[model samples]
Target: MDVATVKKKVIVVMGATGAGKSRLALSLASHFPAVEIINADSMQVYRGLDVLTNKITPAESQGVPNHLLGNIDPSVEFTCKDFRDLAIPIIDDVLSRNRLPIIVGGTNYYIQALVSPYLADDVVEDMAEDSRISRLTDVDLNDINSASAFKLLNEIDPIAANRIHPNDQRKIQHYLSLYSTSGILPSTLFLGDTSRKWGRADNFRYNCCFIWVDAALPLLDRYVNDRVDSMIAAGLLNEVFDIYKPKSDYTRGLKQAIGVREFDEFFRAYFAADSSWVNSLTNDQVSSDDANMFTKPKLSGILNSHDSNTLRALLIEAIDKFKANTRKLLRRQRRRLNRLKSDFGWKMQYIDATKAFQDESDNSWSVWVVEPCVKIVRSFLLEQPGFLSSTGAPYNVLHLTSKDLCTQYVCEACGNRVLRGAHEWEQHRRGRVHKKRASRLNKCQRTFSVDQQAAKSADGELNSTFCNSP
Candidate 1:
């Protein structure tokens, strides 16, 4: 595949957790017909953490093939610098094969490094002088707040201070220690007359096509909630339990993630219980009512026993907060994409799931009704042997309808046929046919559920076929 012939050059999909980076990445990889995904997430690189990290499944990769995921052990301490080193070679290999590289993940810094060649070369060497760096252990780093770290960085290098956001504690600490020991700032080092040749632009080069898949705040929130639920269903708790050492740095990061952190708390609660006490309690085989009294409260109260409800509530709360944060981060990303479009004069397309499908239908003469989840669509695409072209485009994207729903014919109350095409579907939603039916259904004295009405309406009969007719 010639680079010039490609629609998107080197695509980068970025968003917060559960914003659908993996799904978008896989979708683009399948659609672009020339794209290979390069995992930019820090956690996704670790092995044995598919559920916790939301790592793309083998089935979801769709034979499109991904790099840098599940390559490192969770116990290993992999840094951003290590990512850059590994990524460059993989990118080069992809480009050499005439394939496009689509970088995807929530790790903002990783994507930043890849896109900004100047920053990629300004590597932070290991902190020397055991006195200063040793004092700033991983534990210390985790404990320090961003504000304090920013203050320290300002004292060392004001120029770097202005460049880095105060809220970004990780980068602030990294630069602070890097400059304090080396007596040279990253900005100074990167911009020095002799240092220009060492940067990514000077050494390696590739044109990029950046597309961001974004959703409205409401939709994004719902998506995030669904994503957390999916992660839990996929056994995220088990993954966290397998690596829940109190002293480990791995636990710290895991604890920071939304659903995983809740599991950590639950694990702590369980471990704190005396084994002998638990054994005695189990032997007693208390009545259900007695067990309830001893167990912890489900929602928000102290518990005398080991109840799982508290853990469930914690997980739900964590997921809600995570979704809110993810929406905020996605908005920031949208702003960045707009800024990049204005500055670089590159073609940047902002397409959510619905828009992407519409665009595909318009451009390729093929229509698809993709599930809300990207993983499902990706899995469907990749499972077909030879489904993807040599350049990595999906051969055929299938649009599936629910057999149960499709078996029915037209609208019930108004005798209107349910629109089949995307445009027709939209038109039907706006027209009086659906509106009148909705109004009548709301006023109906029958206690039939909305789903029952829909099923009846789908079958083209207003007579209680929805309730009586299966």
Candidate 2:
């Protein structure tokens, strides 16, 4: 079967949040003589935020040697680069021990970093010595507007600047700092450096299979909704409430999990609910200052003056928002995976997991999941392009990694531009700001739900969920 046809190896299972990629990886471990699964998930690296993050349970590990799960406190920072630094050595160690390394995670960016080339720590340290970024860090970033800063960056490093979005303030600032400190543009430094340079696509160290698990949109929507319901039934609310602090910043590591942010409006109301109605919702007292954390203006506006009935209604709405947001994230993940294939020439073995998922308590997962995965992995390793053609994914190019696809989006209606990728587009299309502009421009009736009106506007039906966000 040419199972060993691939080079120094690793197996990465990547997919959306609820697509069962972790389960598939564990099931596949049974076929290997020895395999260690390393965590590449950004959220799962945090110690708490377990149920909300949909962390793999101990029962689900199946006695497999798994690394990096729940290893850090949620408050600390972790980045894609940090993930790559931690995972690459593990991959090397597993290979030295004659064991395969299988990395399964919902974070595609982390997986990309794990496999792609990067600068060595020493080289990075060397670059950091008297580096522009190092100098700029101590300066007040707020003093410069993003537009002016990006323009300055463009003058200094137009090639890199063109590739980086103007709205990406952090990257723009970094570029400016690099130019100011090193006296060389970032693009020039990256390309021209001959000694101890960070790795690029041409530098990836492993011969591996990147398994992309996906499903049709309707099936994915159902899966996300069902998972959200399961999370609730499994006490997701209390799990979040237990670890939550009124002062916790969402910019921190684990706070970025989809479940945490989507439930913000409800938590805010519960925190600042009317004293007369507070007992109806909770036995504990909450401070009004906590209300400052409520940032979603649309949702906040709906629950004006948080009364008992209002809090209860917002609770139901939070559930729907959670489902909607998760569904949206799944869609975004699919888009990113496709972009990964296009940009990095990732040899993706696509799995329609909705078809593979089954109710088999007595039947081993090998039959339903592992067998099919083995077939795909073997085909990929053998370089049998036609083998996966029948599975709707074919190995074509096995190439190097490049920068991620740009995330810039421009709104013609409102001049609301962002570098936040698909979510920005989703929010703009589904949000009230754009709809209001459209209503005034086209004279379409301003309705309670933009999705309903959009469905009607597109065809003669209401397509997506009718939950409207203004």
lDDT against the true structure, per candidate, is: 0.55, 0.66
- Residue 219, model 1: Cα distance from true site in angstroms: 0.7
**Mind giving the per-residue lDDT tens digits that candidate 2 earns over 1-470?**
36663347577888987777887888778776587999888889889867878888888887898899999777766867788888878888998998878889888777766765654222444665555442334445346677887877776667777656676665676566555555455765445333222322334457667788766678778877888888876767766765566655554578867778666777777657544434533654544444323323333344344565877687778889889988877876877787665554556777775555544342544555577788876675556757532123333333322233335566766654544445446656787878888666555444546767677787643343344424
Which lDDT tens digits does candidate 1 get at residues 37-94? 8998877887776776677788988888799988976665566767887898898788
Model 2 scores what on Cα lDDT?
A: 0.66
What is the lDDT, from 0 to 100, of the residue 77 in candidate 1?
Answer: 58
TM-scores, all models, native as reference? 0.57, 0.68
Report lDDT (Cα) of residue 58, candidate 2. Answer: 87
Top TM-score prediction, candidate number: 2
| lDDT for 402 (candidate 2) | 27
Instruction: Point to the candidate with the largest lDDT.
Output: 2
At residue 375, candidate 1 shows an lDDT of 38
